[model samples]
Target: MSKKSTIQVEKVNAHIVNWLKTYAENAKVNGFVVGISGGVDSAVTSTLCAQTGLPTLCVEMPIHQAPSQVNRGREHIEQLMTRFSNVTTIEADLTAVFENFKSIVPTVPDLDKVNLSLANTRARLRMTTLYYFAGIHGLLVAGTGNKVEDFGVGFYTKYGDGGVDLSPIADLMKSDVYALGEYLQIPASILQASPTDGLFGDDRTDEDQLGASYDELEWAMLEEEQGKSADDFAGREKIVFEIYKKLNASNQHKMREIPVCFVSNDIK
Candidate 1:
């Protein structure tokens, strides 16, 4: 399985915890705040932040979220608080807030566009909520994105889940994050659950949306990094490689820094 880590799990855990602690200390922030999505990434990120021995706030901002997601998030937060004194939690139910926003916005003819916009809206709402807590509590917002989502596929929402003060696991792949989750003793309910953003208020999973499994995407990412292309593969491998390339190219805007319109002094 690609889940196996190339490095020592114990040392990686210690290194991340130390890195988080030093970053918080240097920034003069109290600790870290993470948006708990009932997924392995958030569960692992929160656990790592708790290990920093500084304040770790897990905020649940649900907008018509699934009960399973909610339950898993609560379970992880409860376990975290029990295991670490610095860990804390808050539930900011955003169902009503989301409904209000939808009602106020102008309706459009394109249902597909509206649905996609609202799904992203759900993520942005959660992002706003996390920053709110971070602002009032003097904490840094720790991101839960892994390498596959953050860079390989650009699966995250722009300025939404992607808008974070720091990313503890952005360098780790999806499989690597699961490996750390195992080391961190993350709750089995979360560790075993299918990965989802839960933004659509339904049971659809990340794979259903992405059209390929994380393992396949990981293989494609590595292959592309090693200078392979879709033309080199056949059958399912070709399909998955094409999917990865399409998403990687389309979502480059999300993965890269915002483009600035530069004007020379002469032009100005």
Candidate 2:
């Protein structure tokens, strides 16, 4: 955490906690459930949920060939959950889930896409698991999407990882997430580890997939926020825009509600 972040961390933390509480109460939810992938976004979200005094579940769903890094997710979540009244941990094995799609998942040539599909499967499974538990436990599925992922590379699966009862960190960028993590005094080791999804090998990372570091992403996104023309990513800009379009077009339905009409209920 930097000097600037330290100053605003407390306020940001409080704001998000309050936001989740209000959203939950209004939605008639018991608390928040999150899929913790040992990533920064979910880490920040889980901490804020704990600080919000809401029951939170941080699940780690790992796939095949995953490394010891997968264990970090559980440890980090356990540490964060210690501060809350009720925080549960779950291990939803994705090896079986991925097996269901193993045959067809290999069509993509690039390792990134194949891993994305695998990771996406795990994400959807995690979301489904959240709903199953939330329904039984009377809680809500709290999405951990940050603005950089949500807005920039459009970094999320459609109905899969993107499904949520509510999103608390949707407005903050990737960098701000780390800021909140620090204020909550989350473990330093977890805070410093490279942000990743634990999808493929330990090497599979969100930064590598997005083609930019969180810092650079923050700078580029902030420029867009200021109503300025998009910043120059130069050679990578084409691929970046391509990714943005693909995710935007494919996930548009997730961001929309089904249209419905009343059967002349105007009963005047």
Candidate 3:
């Protein structure tokens, strides 16, 4: 969790941009489409796509999103458009769609379950919107997930934010993503903003839900990779290690390939 040495931002940026371009060309897609949530991950992702010199469409699908989040997203899109001619922005406000769906769905007695389900519904709605744009434009849906969120903790909603055509920054750690964001000159508001999924429509951060900060989670991930267990640590470290392990175990279904039932020849 200690401040690590700086990464080779220039080289990393160029590598990802070139990789994106090559992938798009090989896939026969026109370009990339990304959902901008006014967060650092999305901002960095859209910028990387724009750098590919291909048509990068940044879509803002706000479902009861906070005003600050919407403002920051618009700011980043404006900046991106000014910098790259290939970039375009669109706003698909799905507030009414979400409300209508809520009204039609059967009401549950458990408010907690309903809230969680609705939060995930928000993410899935945005995912569907992104794919809609990608479908019409012949573009790939670029994911905005980072290492700690996507693999370490599985913080994203399955078939929601996790659903994507390609992940440009999945391998990079949260710190590494911020480094790239700095090098890419992402807007200061986004860079300084606390990392949130923006699904709950409130100010609760990822740490609030995960029970640990990204730095702590990153440390635990490294420790696990080095063959260390929760027993090795005490106090806060142990707490975080357990939290990381619990999430990793519970969310393994998200990280691995879907299970399938096969039929043997004898059965036939």
TM-score of each: 0.98, 0.79, 0.98
lDDT of model 2 at residue 242? Answer: 42
> What's the distance in Å from true for residue 239, model 1?
0.6
RMSD of 1: 1.1
lDDT against the true structure, each candidate? 0.92, 0.71, 0.94
> What's every prediction's RMSD, in angstroms?
1.1, 4.7, 0.9
Task: Please name the candidate that would achieve the greatest lDDT relative to the true structure.
Answer: 3
Tell me the lDDT of model 1 at 180: 88
Which residue segments of model 3 deviate by more than 4 Å? 3-5
Q: List, residue by residue over 34-133, the lDDT tens digit for candidate 1.
A: 9998999999999999999999999988888889999999999999999999998888999999999999999799998999999999999889999999
Model 2: residues >4 Å from true position, as ranges?
1-7, 103-116, 230-268
How many residue pairs of model 1 clash at the backbone? Answer: 0
TM-score of 2: 0.79
- Order the candidates by TM-score, highest first — what do you get? 3, 1, 2
TM match of model 3 to true structure:
0.98
